[model samples]
Target: MDKLRDFLKSWPGRILLILCLSPLALLGIESYFHSGVDPNQIAQVGDASVSLNEYQSAVNNRRSEILENLEDASLLNEDVLHEQVLRGLVDRALLEQQAKKLGMTVSDDTINRLLREEAIFKDENGNFSNDLFATFLRQRGMTKDQLFAEFRNQLSLDQLNASIVGTAIYPMKAINQLIDLQLESRKVWLHRFNWQDYQQQVTVNDADVKAYYEANKKSLKSPAMVDLAYIELTPEMIKVNEVTQQEIDAQYQSFKQELGLSDDRQISQILLTGSDAKARADAIKARLDKGESFAALAKAESDDPSGESGGAIGQFNPAVFGGDAAAVEQALSGLKVNQASKPVKTQFGYQIFMVTSEGSSQVPSLASVRDEMVKRTKAYKQQTLFADKVTAINDLAADGFGIEDIASQENVPLKRIKNYQQDNNTSALSQPAVIKQAFDEFVIQDQSVTTAIDTGKSTVWVQPSRYRPAKTLSLTEATVKITQVLKQQKASALALKAAKDMAAKIKTEADINKQGISFQALGDTNRQSPLLSDKERSLAFSQPAPKNGVAAMASQTEMGATLIVGDAIKTQQQSQLSAIEKAQTAAIIRDNLGQDQLQDYLEYLRVIHKVEVNDANMASAQGR
Candidate 1:
């Protein structure tokens, strides 16, 4: 019994010691078992415990950080929130995996040093301040120990990342090739032919026209379309109770009071501190005193950012000027025109004040604003009428009234479109919504009356006049296009020959410069320039000798220059050299052309790994 009492007495002291050392003991235990713990596991990898509450807290902090960084709060949406959270979790999981694979570790000393150096945790003296650190952690909803753990995990992952990707260097040959391709430039002259110039070339004979019509029977067919007359409803269309003259006068009085003319100021200032403020201010004052122009003086000397505009602050309601109700009343009390006051200090720093003008706070007469009021009243009435009419039309349509019957009953005009198809693109019925609704199988199959379809700012009613099916192009229709193509080819050949003849006329370097026929110095540009077609760019950089010095000829297209390199230019060109090298390069090119190769690589990696997404949880987190 004596021993038991002794033990009970010691137990209290032992409990106090345990409580004092609990946090450190827990941290030590965590470090010892860290290797066996999988950070990626939401509920601890091995025997460690990652509480759901802890993960949620971290997610919320991350979300808050993102929201704080955005310039516009309205742009935040469910998709953006979901994407950010998922990305953050994925990154965390990836880092955890990487850290474990590399046997990476971070110590408490490292995290402490980082915290001390972090600007967010520093004091005015530029040293680590515990108070600041605590405040920051509190604001972010994180504890010091939790932050340190995250930092440690991050550091280990960073080391692993460096091992896998940081030290890998690209081959010099590859870099050089990329740079050379980027810098390459092509030389050519352009010749343009406008379609308008060839309008006279297009002629239609009666037989030809008939043949064309026959061949393009599908195009000749009219589209199915219907004209719509419907009423629109809007707030402006509704009538409201009339506002009386007395009410108008009251509104105007309120406006005048809100303007605060008696308290309004148009004062100028001379900054007496910082970077020649006093000198500038004095110069401005001298100008103002000399009557050299208040605007000019303000522009030259006033420190107000907008002083250039004659120190104008623009008209504002008193509430917006920091002179709220009380300040407005105080400033207005017994104020006189052109009166100046001693410098006053406010939240926006010191300022001198002057009452440029003063007037009684009285509303304008109703006669002065009657026209505006009348316009508003009429608009309201129209809106109400329009809304009622639209509702009537919708009701009629719902009750199986055809557009023709509705138009007749409404006493409105009826229009018609003939032979319309879903793919028909006539300007008359080219509205996307109209096209979609008109072509819907349900609408066409039942010949059902459709609800009014909104075409942007207006609504329309549509009915099919005719429907056409797909058909093959006829020889007669193709002939004219083929002939036009052949003619263009001939013209192009002539233009090229003329260009070549002009180039051949140049002999000496002096002549080349004198005539300003400079060979375009190649810069690093790849084959992507719309300025150069693929064939032209390829020819410009191709190898092998033709009978002539030119590898091929390059000419200008309607858009830009085209190049056709001669054997001479080909000999000087540098890209993939010899036949063997060219063949190897072509293989690499083929590899790049395989569009799905990268996607397939990613899919393979995904299949080899385990990935589980708690979509419902994610959606809930995003407020979706």
Candidate 2:
């Protein structure tokens, strides 16, 4: 406990402690500080409240998680996301209250068990990996401390549902009933009506269309829209910078030195010391260059113990050496048997090297590494270019430059999108935030260009030509839509009316054939039966089991209406939901019931606490 408390005082431990306690401890902590609700609070549940600041932080984090997982960020629905985050905070608030009331908090052992279950924290063999922990932190741009904090934070959030999971119980009878309902199979006879059959009979004039338009015109209003232009920037869009031969050659030289590539076999070294060592070694090399004997020079004036034996060293087998073996080997690499190399520096001071015998080089040829060198060079250059271009675009936008000018300078095409609206995109620029960011940054601002909107893999800047807030569109603008809707409604009414008329006259399954109704027989279909559409299957199972007669019902669909007739219903037992099988299924059902209980508990808490959510403030939070 002392160790744990001391660790908690460390930066990362403190962060983790904060993560575990935050907004939650804040749930009711503020009540002790102030009596009235804070103006920034987005929701209030009992004495607990969700502040706008906390909600915004969650939104940003959720958005980042979503964007990271998405291939295309444009598909994100901001409104749905906004509501999702808000509801989560609200539910979390309720859970926090219940957990505190029940004195339910996760224990250290429980946390450890839960952490082991999380795959991210474990390696393939299922043990906690410190390297993987560091990697996960790096990927999320977090420090070790923050990740530590996050781990505890995750446990705290999970613990919020302690009351729900612990208290929720599924009655044996209820579980059995669920199994019966879920496992029940029905024999269905499906009659699909062709829309064309009813279309020809139903006629719609201008007056009929006008009446339908007035009733549903609110939905017919044109979406909040913007006519805009934007430039999308992705790393792939940047041209790869060139790699010069000089650079490749330099890298090759480095590779050769590092690998100690050499053709020299039987080698010799003359070790020396002092600042004048290079001068002396150069003088000896000059004498050797003038055809003097290298062994004779080594014998007369070398510091190495091998000097008495003419400084001979064995072939490059990593044996004893006068100085650095790799350095000596590299120096001896270029030397012929009778020749001496220029002085090479070593920790022993300076040394001269010579090869006494010939052998094949251990070093690979230039051609062997040229392709790799080129690829590495190009990749590095491309990355730098991408970063530079993105920075330049951001700077230009900051400097109040128009998007067109910035696009032209960057040499990317400026694409235009007309009447772009939320959840309705016609062009390739689909990231749901494009319009939102555009409206938020460029719409109200006097500026023409939006700030750089980064989606991790890509960035974009939008310039709106016109902005149209959501409003009721004129009759002329919505006439075509209204006409299509009226036509569909009139046709559906006709189909249902005809199907009902036919049903009233039919008395049994035999009468169906007399009425010229042809139904395809679907045998032994369950709730998840692929043979029937969802509506068709629902109608099939919802009707009571026919004791002696047929049960029939009509429902409208896009293809027209379906006339479902049921003559049999059977429970799947012995073969499917056997006694043992039902027990196993009951376990899963119980878990689901637990989740349902959690939702119901949250709902109950909301009602009792007089929970209130400020939508206007929610919108403001979303805008941020």
Candidate 3:
């Protein structure tokens, strides 16, 4: 399932799935072109122009992805999304031009290889199926050539980026310095001065708060609120009759066939990689032919992480391995029980496998899987009823039925919420789809009934009854909040002053306990995560062995201030940078450098090609 989801999120996934979020690898979009007539251009990049239709397609794809991921569609700011989309498209065009100039190309073989490796287009046996691939294209109204072209362009961009990043290297000296700070740890004596302790030292009169309120009155505006009357439709509200025995029997058979109840296999194997993997695999196979124990040799010589378990890779549904599934299945297909196969080449390298067991796939009797099936069928029937009920309720609303009137006709209770503000996100009406409809300009201005809003699991229809514009709050309404704010500020200031005084005492070697401040020992903590606040942690690391070895430092926390006396400090050794860490650090440095280079190249393209953005058209496209 994860593999399928990942495939749906990739370049091909975006093309096949409706949730395409980015236009970074916009390959075959040129296929959307109309008959050789002049098209309205949105932007010009050198000699190439972005058609308005192309930009809209990209924007809509990205918008759909966003709405699917977020709960509240109203949270999407059209202006911001439009700006990002246009910028991304412009950058994509620039990179494409640069790729052409550099003569970088992606071959047809690479595109074919990538598609074959895609998990979603594969059968249950992990083998690529042309039928599944064609189905995906047909569903999205695309052709094979169109998607393949997009893949080629995407691969070219990836190669270009890789070439730029490959040349970047981080100096060992800088890396060592970073390792020291990153791994350093400290043990300390800490003291916290609570702000609540200083509450008695401060006094705030009504006059101060009133004066502060008067000066900030214009800025202290109340959020606009609305009153709503809505209909809530859920699957649980519908009653479902019994599912027929014929329907149950048919569904059970379908499930069994879909789940491949005719075949099953239990396999165990050893995987080996590296330049000598083939030779090593051949050697392993030779040992097996000579009757060497498979598990014993696997435990001794295999490189796979599962080698520790005597190479028990476990049973899989064969169809789960998309890339090299076929080669593996083919090798095992001819092997008898307890028989080992010769070394087989796969994407993960050479592997020697043993078929531990084989049998017909198991199918449970109807009695064994019936209870669960009955519950599922009931829910399915209920959902169908719910959908019909919602449509009827919506029809009533469209025919000038008020929420209460609709509720009476449908025999469902109506819910009304008054003075609802958007910021009260905890409210039921604050649900994404409902909030989007409730606050819609047309819904509020024309008092129109919103289209059925699906909140993923439920459906809601909201109509605004009363709307209130945001305005300055009255003194009576804001007085209590202002008083609390003033009190907190006064307490914090007094606490900060007291903390500074205590810090001075600690530096002078005075007993903190005597001054009524209890101290606790914090042992061996890195600045990245400490018992103290971030500021205090940073201050502890910065203090220079404390003057005369007194070993003390001071910093502030959210509640008040803190003083710490370092008991011991442990610095990470440069020798601790393992080979794996070195490679990881180098990769991080290379990636950052690659991004910087890409940004600079894009800027250079903009200057040379004289890129022009059409703000008017962009605004129109965003439906501003």
lDDT (0-100) at residue 530 of candidate 3?
Answer: 40
Please report the candidate that would top lDDT against the real structure: 3
Candidate 1's TM-score = 0.38
Best-first order by TM-score: 2, 3, 1
lDDT of 2 at 556: 82
Candidate 1 per-residue C-alpha lDDT over 476-582 given as tens digits, one digit per residue, 9 for 90 to 100: 65566545544454455555555555545443323334434435534433456565556556655554334423233435455323433323321125543665665
Better of 1 and 2 by lDDT: 2
Alpha-carbon local distance difference test for all models: 0.48, 0.69, 0.72
Candidate 1 — which residues are off by over 4 angstroms? 1-92, 185-530, 533-539, 544-548, 553-563, 566-605, 613-624
Of candidates 3 and 1, the better by TM-score: 3
Which has the greatest TM-score? 2
Clashes of each: 41, 5, 3
Model 2 CA lDDT for position 136: 54
- Each prediction's Cα RMSD? 19.4, 9.2, 18.0
On TM-score, the stronger of 2 and 3 is 2
- CA error at residue 277 for candidate 1, angstroms: 48
